[model samples]
Target: MQTVKNFSDAELITAIKTGTNIDNAVGFIYRSYYRMLENFVLTNSGNEMDAEDIIQEVLVVFIDIVQTQRYRNEASVRSFLYTLTRNLWISELRKRNSDSKRNGFFEASREKEEEDVSDFLIYKEAQVLIVELFERMGEKCKQILTLFYYENLSMKEILKQTSYENEQVLRNRKYKCLKELTDIIQQSPTIINNVKSALQRSK
Candidate 1:
């Protein structure tokens, strides 16, 4: 895997188009966009499973275009991939809702406002770390933390959702889950500092 440096989008495209194979090309795309796509999916009403499936679909679509020599350099490859993934996710949500009897409606899309490239990079890295930390926790921890933090549901809401007997039990579980997440963040010094820098830079 070659490290993706400062290659202009045009140069990368040319290399990809002329190379004997697509391994490097695919890796470059993954390294550049995987975190952004994952964060977009997870933050936009997608679960980890949904995010994984969507990313795979995005890669498949990208590869198909590349193999068919159809990826024009009219726009940055990054923008093209992001738009493709976004459209695919929207299409998937419509399909899912159409197939199921669920009553909840999909919310409006949240487009990330453009920021300094460095800040965007760090913010994305932080999100990736948080997602990994959540995945590493126990199932109970994941559910509790996600309800309180990611879903922004109140204690009563969490209690009802989890079917807990009382508020006290819910509070205890929430505290424990949050503590575990904090510990995970504390352990990753590089990620913590990077995120801090990103936030500071944004301000």
Candidate 2:
């Protein structure tokens, strides 16, 4: 196998920002960080697949931060990357613990250091709740809402993809679906509490 090229902190940041040499930079990042992060997750009650998924998600967030010039040079890129990945994994653990509690399973205790990740964990919890509530919506509502909001499709584009008779009808359906989702969210005490907690943490 060919050796993947390595990148220094400056080199990697430059490549990511300029959108050039990105493939090699990303390859280097994965090769360099994967094993360490994988070992961390595996030791912390997660499996290899969980480590892979968490790394992928954290990489996406890292890339976005780099692209948007939001990455401060306060720390080395590797350290920053590892911190983000660790925080994300901790949030995942907290979410899983919450699920286990709901199922009457034994919940694991978290470390004091993990409490620092509560803001992110709360945000992630609210996000999961929204997704769950969205899935509980009617199939038609799900489709139209996804096409319009998540997919960022225009009304005309949605009409083409869907079997809607006209843009107006699709618009009406979208409004109703949104209202339904909003009502469902409003009625969900768990979601309400999570959102409130997230907001308070943000403040």
Candidate 3:
């Protein structure tokens, strides 16, 4: 049998960001984090299968965050993965009316401080909606928005990278792309409410 090599936090982030060796990275994540999280869920009124589903969903969210360059490297990859998996499992337990006493015990035993789960869920929901809206946009709009917002490129830098002839043209296109995204977001009442709730929580 072959062994999968583990990646350092930096190495994992690079692999995910560049779309390089992602399979190896993902395999490493499963081999490393799955059992620990499975045990966690199983002890907290969930079965092995439920743990698997929760871990899978956490990986999806982790990959999306990495791809979007939203991960701040404030914590090690392992720590981040564990935190997300734990929170997700807790959310699931709450939904299923699991043993509250067991849930409280497990939650209290965790080493890290508890995150605001409601805020985390709201943010994730909004992120999904934003990603969907971005995908539905035209290629040009996607490129412009990605450059300006995600990549944090200046107007001049954007013009240099893109086919737009002038800064003014790029700026106008950016405005339209933003407006288009806003329109798409407005169509989703759930997203709007989540965004509002998140904002209120932040305030």
- Global lDDT scores for all candidate models: 0.60, 0.66, 0.68
Q: In model 1, what lDDT does residue 54 have?
A: 64
By summed lDDT, which 10 consecutive residues of candidate 2 come out lowest? 98-107
Candidate 3: tens digits of C-alpha lDDT, residues 1-203:
88768898899899877779988998888888888878878886777766766676677667755654457676778778777877776655544455654456564655432343334544654554456667878999988867754554655678899998876677667766765765565567676665556546553
Give the runs in model 2 whose Cα sits over 4 Å from its true position.
1-3, 98-203
Count backbone clashes in candidate 2. 0
Higher-TM-score candidate among 1 and 2? 2
Could you list the CA RMSD of all candidates, in the order they appear? 17.1, 13.2, 15.7
| TM-score, structure 2 vs. true | 0.51
Candidate 3 clash pair list: none
**RMSD of model 3 against the true structure:** 15.7
lDDT of 1 by residue, 1-203 (tens): 95555445776676555553355666777787888988877876777766665676566545434433446455577876676666656555654444342223234343342123223333433455456778978988888767654565655667788867986677666656655655565467675665566455555
Worst 10 residues of 3 by lDDT: 111-120
Per-residue lDDT of candidate 2, residues 1-203 (tens digit): 98768899999999987779988998999888889878877876777766776677567656645653456676777677767777766555544444542332124454443343344444543455556767989999888867654554655677898888986677667667765765675567776566556545554
**Where in model 1 is the C-alpha error above 4 Å?**
1-7, 19-21, 98-203
TM-score of 1: 0.44
